[model samples]
Target: MKEFLGTLGQTTARAYGEDLIDFSRWFEESDGIELVAGLVTTLDLRDYLSHMLTVRGLKPSTINRRLAAIRAWLQWAKRKGAINDLPVFPRHLSEPKRAPKSLDRVEEARFLRSVAREGNVRDNAAIGLMLYAGLRVSEAVSTKPSDIEIGERKGKVIVRNGKGMKRREVPINADGRGMIGPWLAKANSDYLFPGSVGGHLSPRTIQELIKKYAYQAQLDPNSVTPHVLRHTFATKILRSGVDIVTVAALLGHSRIDTTAIYTQPSWRDLERAVDGREGGNGE
Candidate 1:
């Protein structure tokens, strides 16, 4: 299965294929069914969900994506007549109730400084995009040299296969573009951050790099993941008074509501509200 996924040659496929294999192993271990017979029913789907939730203790979002991959695989198998019955599916919840994690300006600075000392161009660029551009780690690593247009005044990054497979182009200012100089110069291959085998960087390796830098910066490495870098970018921009709509588009979010979740109220916001309440006017 991994070999088949390797043919796809995209990071997203790699993750999905592994998830499918994991699901099959989980089902076999839990239900004693080495062979998933034809025509899976809704019951089987529900049972799998129950196991993931109760036994594995997976969070709602992770569990949902894994189940989705399983369901899609089953549907394809059924079409191929690999299974007689369709696997049963479980009811999906509306959303995960967890808040997204972000870093403050001080922590963000420390993280970037730590990575600068790592002395790996690809690693710095891959992590920098998350901190500056609010890119998902996958999006940053998969970024192609072609997708970036660094300019004197403004720059842009094209992100393919973002959340829900959406594509969006985001503007980068001088600071953000400056961070990529070494990465672009050192990047000889197509991908901005090529893996040991070429193509996109390994997601696992990037996670490890994040952990290492977090420790050096004297921060909680457990809390300092790639997503935290992305969150820091979004929160910093929003608090700096960038409009929510523009932030949403830059983050490749499909909905403004999703972007709204990242918005942080700045000190100025509180001061403004209080000033208005007290009827303060220009002296």
Candidate 2:
């Protein structure tokens, strides 16, 4: 197990290790099995899946993740000659498809107002990059003052190390420029949003900051994250009739299908459509 985990990155190894521990404990306690890779049968995996879904009431995604960890470990054990034939793993549980969450116009206004009321220039600008420029939290934190270029009528933020270390340039509109200008003027640190330890702020810190203002705005803090803010930006841009290719570029999505999620109707949108049709019928 240690050898298998050593092949993974530290964070991934830690998570996969925890998953394996859980699986091992359940194997001993529930099934009286020793959890040897060679002796574990397909029935054991099926039982584990049932236990996770019915007894633990785990989400499909969580169950799938745990199962994935187990699968990887077993594969490694097989390659090392611990097992001659691999047990057939059960199929993953089906996860429901849902549109990416984003704030509506009213919620966005309230959230921005709360930020304006309580947040400093740094907070506003950091949030703006995600909410207006559609930067991922990592991309936003890694951004330097020199990466931004604001002209009289136009501006862009250069994401040097985006997801997969791919670079992209995102144009900044008036809203983004308004929030960023003040911070850039007063910027001193090498990073735009410096951390206490002298590096850029961690993604968790940025997430917590968004949650703080989300609570202040009287919105569900769980629903309003940095990714949701990025989704909001994408939704807004796409709704304005911008092409999908353009939106994909702005969001640094390699695939247009990834950007197409913004086009999916939200629950609110579906409700409004239904309400409008009912009103028309009544009229």
Candidate 1, residues 1-283, lDDT tens digits: the string is 3433454548768778878777778667766786354534567668778887898888888888987777666666666667776655777755633336778667878877887787877777777678778888888878888888887788888888798999988877677887876677666788888778767877778899999999999999999998888887888788789999888888888788888776545454456678877887512
TM-score of each: 0.59, 0.68
TM-score quality measure for candidate 1: 0.59
Query: What lDDT is obtained when candidate 1 is compared to the true structure?
Result: 0.76
What lDDT is reached at residue 63 by model 2? 96
Instruction: Looking at model 2, report the run of 10 residues with the lowest lDDT sum.
Output: 274-283
Local distance difference test scores for all models: 0.76, 0.91
Per-candidate clashes come to: 14, 0
In candidate 1, stretches whose alpha carbon ends up further than 4 angstroms from where it belongs are: 1-99, 264-283
Candidate 2 clash pair list: none
After superposition, candidate 2 runs with Cα above 4 Å error? 1-96, 280-283
